[model samples]
Every structure is written in C-alpha cells, then in structure tokens.
Target: MLPGHADFALPAPAAPVRLNGRRPIPEVPQMNGHSEAPSANEVPPANEAPQPTRSEKPAEPIDVWDQRVAGALAFLRRRLAGNYEVDDFGFDPELTDALFHPMLRVLYRDWFRTEVFGVEHVPVDGGALIVGNHSGTLALDALMLSTAIRDQTRAERHLRLLGADLVFRMPFVSELARKSGATVACNPDAERLMSQGELVGVFPEGFKGIGKPFADRYKLQRFGRGGFVSAALRTGTPIVPVAIVGAEEIYPILADIKPLARLLGVPYFPITPTFPWLGPLGLVPLPSKWLMRFCPPIPTAHLTEHADDPMVVYNLADQVRETIQATLLELLEKRPDPFGL
Candidate 1:
C-alpha cells in the first residue's frame, strides 16, 4: 500500500495461507506415467486413434409406378369399401355398370386429359364449401365432381355433400350415398366436416334444380336466403362456385306430380318420359354430356367484422349466383357438346 499512496488504506487478505512445498503442487487426479510428468491436455497418441465407423447399407431402390398403384388401391379401399363388395343396397347393377365402370375408365385413362384452372383457389388443407348448380337428372353431377377433384388434385378430401331427405329414406339410395361419402344437408354435419378441412358440395337449389320444369332448363332457381353464403361467412372459407352443364338434358321433367308428392311424402314427383311406368329402366339417367367448371375462389379474408352481417351474406350470395349464371351462359354459347373438352 505504501508503494501507491501512503494515505490509502489496504484491504485485508481473504484467508491466511502457508507454503506446503518448495514447488507448486498440481490440482488433479493422478495419471499413470511411464517416463515423465505430462502437462494438462498432453494426451498419448495411442489414446487419440481414430474410431472405426460402421458401413451404411445401400438405400433401397424406389419404384414410382408401384407407389402410384399402391396409393390408388389404398384410396379405393378406403373410399369404395362396399363398392367392391355387395353393399347394403342390393347388387346395384346400374351403379356398377353406368357409374363405376365409366369412372374407372376415366380414372385410368382419360381423367388426366381434362384441364382444370384456379386449383390454387382451393385450400390445400381445410374445409372449403363448394356451392354448385345441381343438374343432370339425379345428382350425377355431384358424383362426377367428387371424382374430378380426387382424380385431378390427388386430394382424398371427400365431398361431404348435403343430400336431400329423399335420398336417406330410400333403402338403396341411402347406403350408396353413405359409401360414396355423402351426408344430409344440415349445418351441424357440414360445419363438423369443414372444421376438419374437408371439401363440402352443396346444391342450395335442392329439389328446385332437379324438379325445375323442362321449359326452365339451365335457368337457376332462386338461391335460398344466403344460407350457403352464411355457411362460408361463419366458417370463414373461400366460396367456389361450380357451374355444371349437360345435367339439364338428362331425363327432362316435362311435368310435376304435386298430388303424388303430397301423398308420397316427397317433393315434386318427376314426370319424365320413362319413370314409374318404365319402372327400374327409367332410373337410368340419360347420358347427357357433362361439364363441371370450378370458377375462381371468392375471398372471404377481407370482410373483417362485417362477415356476419345479413347484408354481406346477401351480397355474397348474389355475387355467387351471378357468377354461376354468367358462367352457364358462356358455357352454353361456346361449348359444342354437353361434356366439352
């Protein structure tokens, strides 16, 4: 302390120490030595020999075609369970011959030939509500639409379609619908599916489209009070407007059976050229050329808080209707056949 400043007071030492040996001692475990004492980190060369490595086996060769086949088979097994076996609906020759055979041929051969636009509009993984015009006698349009999505996009997202009450009541029809992945037209079921990121097909027209008089073919009936629009608004999903052509010409209903409908507990009774009197043969839908156009997705991301507003719902519904109507007009004028390229 005197070397720096005589006035400065010096701090006391932490602890008293005493010298033990002439040389400073080492602070570590004892090490075996043959020749001389070694400094820290002075490991022997033998101890530093490189470790042996296991040889990795060659990676198995891949078969891309095998993967595709397996994928298609697994997909068929899951979706078309009863389809292969005899379903709850007795042996459906018509469905087997007419629908499935054609579908398989398309899937294996021509399905890829069709062109699709605005696929990006569809969410890669979410519940999307697709509101479309129902046509082609029965909901054959729905079946093809589902098939188209699956075949084209490689999306296994089954369209949990909102089917009519009549479908469930019928013994055969109900089972087929269940196997083909369709459910009733209700909000609970729809929301549950959409929440799971599934695609849902809704024909808001319902009986109106199927039962619309022959004179009014292709003229879209009034879409119910923004019900589907509300569904989208509630779920906050993009609405895809699907316009279907060629369904109109199939079994055109020239007349209605209001009396028969009331008695049979069904909507308008169809008076086609060959139904009821024609018996089972009448059920065969006329092979009208079909075209399904999935228009651009309408964004719901922008509405902010007004998504729940009734006026918003109404406007959205009108926009969808107008879009479909315009698309239908364009399709009718341009396309040569019902099932256009």
Candidate 2:
C-alpha cells in the first residue's frame, strides 16, 4: 500500500488472537474417576468445542472395501463426465485404472500370488525402459508385469508397453490394447514416449519368447536385433532389467499347430495341456506363484549419441539380457515350485 497506485489501500487488520496468542489447554478427561486441575496459565473454555488434532484420525473405523469402491466410483464418474485423462498414444488412464487394473490386480494377487523385489530400482518419476523375458503361450506375462508396476511402484505408474505390429492389426484386441496403454513396438514410438517421460515396457523376445515350447520354459530367447536398446539409447532412458518367473508355467504350451497358424494367418497356434483339447475353457490361465525381480537400472542417458550405433546397441542389449538371465536363475533358486512360494 505504499507508492503504487491511488487505489492502493491500507493492509487489513490481523485477525484477533485468543488469550494473547495462546490457546487454552484442553481438559484431560478422567480415566479413573479423577479430573486433573488446570494450571494458572491454562484455562479451558467450558463451551468451546474441541478441535481435532493434526495427528488425530476419525473415531469410527474406516472400511477398506468401502474406500476402494468409493475411489473407483469417483474415477468412473470423472471418466463419464469427459474429464478423463489419456496420453497421446490413446492410453485411457482413468478407464484403465477403474476397469482393467482391477482385473489384473485380482490375477496378480489371488491367481499368481506374485512377490516382487528390487522395486526401489524403478524411478518414482520420469521415463524408464523395463525389459523382460516374455512367455506363457500368450502375452499374459506382459499384463502381469504391468500389474507388478502398478502394485510395486509408489506412483502406481502406467507402463506404456511396446507390442508387436500384429497387436495393433487385430479388431477388439487392438482397441483394448491401445486403451490399456500399449503402442506399436517400434523405435519411433518408444523414443517419443520416453522423451515425454513415460515408463516404456518392452519384451524383445516378441512372439518367439512366448511361442517357445514348455521344454524351453525359462530360457530366454534372443532379444532380437537390439531395437529396444536403440530406442532406449536414443531417448536416453534408464533400462531396468525385469525378470519374471512362473509365467512360463501358466498355460505351458505343450505343442503348436503350424497348419492352423498358416490358415489363420497368424503366429504359431499353441496347444497347451488344456488348450485346443479343452477348447475355449483352456483360456483360463493356471494359478501359478510368480516372482518379478527388478535389478538396478543400467543407465544410458550419459552415453554419447553413438550409443544408438549397432555395435553399442548390441553390446548394451547383451548386457541387459545377461543381467535378466542371471536374475532369473537367482529367482528360480529362490522359488521351489511354480505353484508354491
């Protein structure tokens, strides 16, 4: 209110304070039929209502299921009101959380009995590349990994998965995948997402890893051409080596129908113990205990632009694969049975 303008006004008077800035101490309710006397400086206003303390919680206990249902409803309302948030790649965050994430949560908890380690390695913010060995006759492992990120990470970060071209070419599957926060598995898409600070997930093993027979269960297939590495290098994203155990046992692909695949114009048609023989009923994934271990991130942001060079990418990809393989072996040692612990 000094030398600015004629409209400048004097500062408003401060709000009145009680008892010269000291609040009267509250009464101590008697526990043994004895009320304590007040001190000279302390005076309790008999009519003044007690205010809840900063550390105080409600007297009534909160129901856990109620809170979760309320949250989900609120989220759904926001989405219904067209206040939904989605990324450029068509990742509908609110819908995914309210709808699909719950389904995945059940599978992660009840079906898989999943245990996670090295969660601290995942950056609470910013972009990261999570590379894992893929399997399960289906890409159920990918969904499980996504569930792991949602469960393990403090931020409950959305993992923008890079999937094969075939994924985007399907009908309902394509739309579902896009809405579930997946995009084409290519260098450009991965780079763009990382640059925008998304946690990108890649299974370089592609269909090969998932299609491999039950005999080759945990043995990770080749990580293919190091394209994921190149994307990571170009975007300078930290690459987290994620090793998943127990996905291999889910469907347990026993044999493959090559003729059926050719007729369907698709990849190998898996014939699991229950699948084909059991028809659609086999689609239900077997309950298997799962472990997802995240090793320390291999930093690539500091590397020179040449990090995208084939040789550099090849080397980095090899390093990440070795790290995942070693961690997988260790997780296997720790896990006794696919269904137990």
- Global lDDT of each model? 0.63, 0.80
Model 2 C-alpha lDDT per residue in residues 1-341, reported as the tens digit of each score: 56765652212222111111122212223352222223222322322434542223355335544777898788768777888767688998877886899899788877787766677788999999999999998899899889888866768898889999999999999989999999999888999999899999999999999999999988989989999888888888999989999999999888898999999988899988889878889998988878778878889987649665898999899888888887788778767777774
- The runs of at least 3 residues in candidate 1 whose Cα sits more than 4 Å from the true structure, single-residue gaps closed, are 1-120, 337-341
Q: Which candidate is the best by TM-score?
A: 2
Q: After superposition, how far is residue 10 of candidate 2 from its true place, in Å?
A: 68
TM-score of each: 0.65, 0.78
Reference-based lDDT, residue 285, model 1: 64
Q: Alpha-carbon error at 63 in model 1, in Å?
A: 16
Predict model 2's lDDT versus the native: 0.80
Tell me, by lDDT, which candidate is best: 2
TM-score of 1: 0.65
